[model samples]
Target chain A: MKRLTRMQIPYRVWMFLFIVIPTLILFVLALTNMNLYQIGAFDLTLDHFAIFSKNEIGIAFWNSFFYSSITTLICFLIGYPVAYYLSTLPNKTRKILVSLMIVPLWSNMLLRIVAWEKVFTADSYFTDLTGISLNLIGTQTAVVIGLVAMYLPFMIFPIFSVLEKMDRSLHEASKDLGATDFQTFVRVTFPLSSSGVISGVIMTMLPAMTSFVLPARLGLGTISLIGNVIESKFMKEVLGSSGMSINEGAVLSLFIMVLSVAAFMMITRVDKEGETLI
Target chain B: MKKRLWKTRAWKALGIVLMSITFLFLYTPIIVILTLSVNSSKRAYSFEQFTLQWYVDVFRDPSITGPIVNTISIAILSTIISTIVGTLFAIGIHSLQKKSRIRMMILNNVPVVNPDIVTGISLMIIFSLLSFTLGFTTVLFAHIFFSIPYVILNVMPRLKRLDPNMYEAALDLGCSRYEAMLKVILPNISTGIIAGGLMAFTMSIDDFVITYFTSGNEYMNVSTWLYAVLGRGQSFTPAAYAYNAMIFAITIAIILFINLKKEKKGKLA
Candidate 1:
């Protein structure tokens, strides 16, 4: 056992190098004006903080929050019942259905986003077949629909797994105690699966909150999330755009990272082993 | 009693309908992609006719083939490396005291939960800070970094389920520690390792955000390639749809095979 501990040293070093160091660098970059182009003129300045006050940044933040919240809520409302129903399913049926849910995830996400873009756009293949032109591109509804389609599985699996592994006797016990089906669920099943619900919510919300591609495609330049801002900033630096600021991107990244860590800490409080994370 | 039974039947029908709708929502985009793959139309906006020309073009086009090759090669390399290293890490972590194990799990999760944009940007920052050029090697490193945690998490649960005395018994039977690990431990946890490898491959194959930041001017996987094509406002060859459809078909086949095999094993048992 003691000898085996040596194997972890390498992984520990890898983690430190990649995870710990980069996060520290992000924090430092967020606070200072230091960037790739001007590495020698290193000085701490809180100037990047002013971006938070910008109207665009505030709107981007609000859009991220609003869209992600709606996406998560829709996923939960759809997912929880679906998960509960799936949990009641026979074994072979349940397995097949669950795999069906996950198959879309295995597809290239960008391609799927593009597919939705086609469906939402007017004069699409869908319209060619159905004779109904949606022309929904650039709408908030399109982005939300794309998001829910992409991430609903994240919501379902956690709740389903928790419910599947839940003590079946509890439901029976509640029934024997004269609880109605609704009472049994509300008092027994839902509370027990709350951890899974939390896990599912966080999983769905985090990705939805940070998603850039869906908004870029479905929103069609009408919508911008914080993620799109970060992407453009980094891309600008890469493209050598004039007035490129990686530091501003770093600030936004740090803000998102803090939100993520806070969400993760909530998960740890409920699920110590970090199970259901998948 | 009749009214209650009628209500229960109604609820069941509603449940089935809801499930059907959710599944329909999930599969609609995939169905569209599959349809568009063989559509004779060059543009995804409208269907011109039915043809398999795009499917043939998938193998013929350089841009399409190049990204397909990159996506597979990176997924393969990262899956293999991460599975091996992550298995060892899981075993190592399994040997630790409780406090350290919990701490390590928290550290393991940073990559797992961190937003892809942040992860990409942070890694991009660090690579530039180190003066390491971003391209194939950086992309490979980034894949491996994010992937190992999944492997570890998948393998950890198996390690927990293993009998504590199995290794000791192997040792008492004259097996060396290395032999004990190989003959006793590895065999027991092989399923977890395989699942983890599959997961790593899945993640790597589909990744865009991290690869986008780290891929620099040289490398492009399918997702990043699609992003680039779309970013330029160019209508890409429908070969992309063909490629994605092929992947979907292959994944379905693999999953069905796995499930069928599991069913056979269960019946035999």
Candidate 2:
């Protein structure tokens, strides 16, 4: 074992301050009733957990869950085939296709969501040019479309990379067993790609469930996701005099944190060693 | 057998069709935005001519330009900071025992896997708890915080592949620890370091949620700015589209040029 060097100390401090302490603070804040003004007389309570029972918050949770799962399902339906096809392509073309998928992922996502929002907006260029109206801007459908577009690349990359690295002999052996192509895919390809599917679900689902921008923009501020709820709780003057207090926001934020952590654990459990990650 | 062959061919044709449609779906937004940026038509739907007027407007507009400058500076500064800190942390953790290393790695994944919203609010909580005003400093700190994981992920793999003897060999030859690191170890991880830095830079620039939470009311990166105006119904000008179009064009050209150059070198080699 190497001796601990002095070089590790500063980063340890940095980590302690930035990473470790902030997480501890999250838990502490969640359990305690401390706000900006209530520095003293701190008492632990789970009452804020009851905030989830509030009709609006509960609806937002369900809305986020519904939209995110549907988005994940749609991304899989679209991405799985794209991933499989790309994996079978010649190496050069496969490389190009993979890079093209990643290209959009790098662009500023806010701009993309805004651009997508226009498709459903009144006086939209799509409607104006095609003589057809989407008229869905303020609807949940618009928000779902925006989420899918924003996260589509995330779904594709995970599945494609997993498929790319998968041993081809499995498929070939299945074919030698007198199975049809669709049978070979269903029995062998799909089962083997389950880890990728799982990872893609985690990748797409978490972001979708917690997405604030899409619902804010495409929903035209009419719809709220779990993320929007959290944002408003903190960002709005919802503390001290007239706003919802801090501890309640922490409870919601902690709910999201637990949801993602569970997803991460499920992912790690499936691929225990992080092999499925792109 | 003959029927199976025909079916396979049919499937291939279907595959091509599916691929084309998917490509169109993926490419439409960028193409549309780029076109809209240059479209000279008076209406949102009209594109009777092409002009660079929006690009000019984007450059001249103080509100947009301020966010642009802020975004670039924050991105660059956070990238540099994260690169240095993350690379150092990666080295430290690499030297640790296996159990601690794995534990540290999982802890590292927390921010990566945590939804940005949760991370944003938690940090926001800490800042307000400490009575630190949410502003540029808080946003930059948040960016650096979230960015370190990317750098560590990139660097860790390279560190594991490092030749243990190189540093020791240099040390045995009378080089000090720092000198050995500088001469022997640094070069090995340079590629990983640069890649990590670039990823961090992009993540910083593309970030909105965390910045939205931590930037308070004063600072607005291009993302937060666009998102703010976007919520106000068509508060976005075509100029915003022009800014991103220029970015997309530059990114594509650079990537293509690099790919082509690599291909040519492969042929020559």
Candidate 3:
């Protein structure tokens, strides 16, 4: 057993206060009936759960899920090819390309969302060119577009890492056996990179589901994803009297937490299945 | 053989085309914003003429300046605090036994994977319960909350790779634990810390969702200010574009510097 140092106690206590305490408060607040101004005695109630079951919340939850799923799918479709292409490049070029990809990540995410708003807002150039006025600014389509754009790098990076480590001989041997390039890619490359694909999908989907800024900004406050709903409950005073009931927000929070956990579990399970197949 | 060669060339051309298209999609909006910043047009998104008036406006306007200062202050403070705390926590965690490390690792990753909205709402709820005022302090605290996880994750890998015996050697030479940590551990992990700090600073500066929820209308960060502006159905402000360009330029410069440093280190090694 390592000896516990005197200084460690204060550090551990600090962590407990900052990290664990907030988490506990979130749980208790989710369970109790409390308003923003009234910090009275806690009464445990399932009213929040009922609120979640009612109109708008259910629809919002479904919308958040479907949007995230579609974004993840699109990210996978686009990112996989890019990842594959990057993996095939010479080392120096590959390094430069990877660096370029990550450079955008360093920029502020909100800034990027605002940049998209510039593109898709009514009377923007895109609308003019297409002739079809895509009212994308406040639609689910805009949210999906933003999520896919923001999360593309997450999908690409993992797949690129996996592809870089793939055995070159497999492809060469398949070619020598007179297999076409497409066949080799389908039979060998796709299967081999499945773990990365699973991880990338998970990484993209998990964050996409919970994202607030992009959806809230582009969705024009018309569509309330779980994130926006929760924010409204806690901060906007739109749900209950003077900042929606904490208990309701908390119940919704628990639902979100469960959804996220389930999404993660599905990803891991898929990853395991892919690994076994490989 | 000629046909095969032609096919290979065609494939290469296709790959390049695909990559360029992707790049266009990724960068056009940024380019558009930068261009509009210099455009002489009062109306945003309509290219009337070219001028530097927007940059001038951003500098001259108090409303813009206040939010810019607030964002910079919060980012700088959060980066500094989180870097210190995260570096210390990472060092301490590295000293623990392998068997006891799983829980700590999971806890460390919680902030990153937890949805930002959930985190924001939870923090808001918790702070209000504790009677913590929603202001600069609350925002800073919230920023630090997420920032520390990134810093710790970045620094810990570097710390683990360090030679454990180095600390013992320093202590045997009569150096105190603080001296050993400062002299030995810190230098090794400085790069990771800097990288993490830069990331944290950018995230905090750019964050709107968490800041929006926690800020409580006390003061405006750049993002929150922009949201308010945009919500009013006003055209994109040229000043906002200029501000964004400044942020973009800084981000690009940092990335280029990091890349150059890595290359230089690679060559030296």
Candidate 4:
């Protein structure tokens, strides 16, 4: 390791203060009654946990989980074939297609959601054509759609990476043994791509679970996912009359953190188990 | 044999259909926004005619213009800062031993995988506690914070691929440490730096959640501006559509330019 110089000290201090300190503050706030106006000078309290346990919080958490799970499933169903097809294409064509998949990702996320809003709103062509209006704008379906659009590339890239690296000889051998193409894929290709599938699932699931913007925008202000609930508690009206206490917000944030950590652990465990089985 | 050939062709046709539908689903909303931006009708969805009036309106309107300028400025500045800092971190981390490298990698992954909302609120709370006003500076900082990890992730992989012997050879020739780094190390890693910078700039421009929390009432970014306008239940104007189309067009142009440059270089080599 390079020895630290005087010039490096200031940069190190800046990182510690900005990145490391903020994370530490998050941990501390998760445990205490750090109110909006007061900052609660070291007063430890578990009252916030009570608020987090309420039906509203539980329901929001469940809804977030439910939506993310459905989004993951949909992405897997849609992305798998596209990934397999892309893998079979010549390299140059595959690159162009993959680039198209990523182009939407480069645009502003909020604008992307707004584009969907324009698509599903009452005046949209879908509504115009069907005449029976589907209220997708402020529903759970909108959230799921937004999530699928946002995370599709994440799913595709991982699956593509695995598929691209897969040995074609294995598929040929499976076919040569008198198995049909479908049988070859089911028995050989799908199992080999499980790592990529796991990766895509994790990538899609984590972001979808924690997404605040899409839901807040498309799901309307009243629709509270875990993320929306946390944001509302922290920034919207924590000190006001209608606002819950700061401790309550902290507890909710803590719950989210716990859930995320557990999910991470579960993913890692799955990866390890998959590796052993393979 | 004829039946098998027919079945295979049918399967291929099915594959194409499935792929096309997926692509349509992914891109239709964006395509709608682009088409509607040029539509002459006052109504949001009606496609009676087409015009460039919305593009004119977007340019002429100060409210829209200001946010667009702010978003660009923030993105450019954050890209510059993050590229420099992230490159340095990548260098520093690369210099570490194996165990510490793993630790650094884990530390870096936190920002990438952490929920944007969580990072935003945490930064918001910290900035408020420190008495920093949530405005331009806060927005810039938030962007830099999020962008650094991406830059580092992109750059570090290239750095790992770099051969250490080049530095040793430079030192053996009696070159100064600074010269060795500037002449030998920087050139080899330039592509990684450029890729990282592009990614960082794109992320900074595209970010909404963190920008929302850190940006105070004093200023509005393009994303925030769009959000506010959409929330007010205003009719979709052609100008708004043109502005969005412009964003999409710029993205396509940039990607094309980059890919073309890479292809030309490959051909030359």
Question: lDDT scores for all predictions?
Answer: 0.88, 0.79, 0.74, 0.75
Enumerate the chain B TM-scores of all models.
0.96, 0.91, 0.92, 0.91
Q: How much is B132 displaced in model 4, in angstroms?
A: 1.0
Any residue pairs clashing in model 2, and if so which?
A238-A243
DockQ winner, 1 or 3: 1
| Residue runs of model 2 more than 4 Å from their true location after superposition | A1-12, A129-132, A173-188, A237-243, A272-278, B10-14, B41-45
Higher DockQ: candidate 2 or 3? 2
Q: How accurately is candidate 3 docked according to DockQ?
A: 0.35
Among these predictions, the greatest lDDT belongs to 1
Prediction 4 global C-alpha lDDT:
0.75
lDDT (10s digit) by residue, model 3, range A1-278: 13212323444665576557766766676777655457767787666677866789888888788988899888877788788888889988988888777666655566677768767777764344334345579877888777877888888887888899899999999889999988998998899888788778777887787777688888887777777676666655554454545667777777777765665455445542122111
* Top-TM-score structure, candidate number: 1
Report the lDDT tens digits of candidate 4 across residue range B73-123: 999999999899888777777777766665565556556656777678777
Task: Give TM per candidate.
Answer: 0.97, 0.91, 0.86, 0.88
Distance from true location, Cα of A70 in model 3, Å? 0.5
lDDT measured at residue B112 in model 4 versus the true structure, 0 to 100: 61
Q: Give the DockQ (2 decimals) of all models.
A: 0.74, 0.51, 0.35, 0.42
Worst 10 residues of 2 chain B by lDDT: B39-48
lDDT of 3 at A213: 69
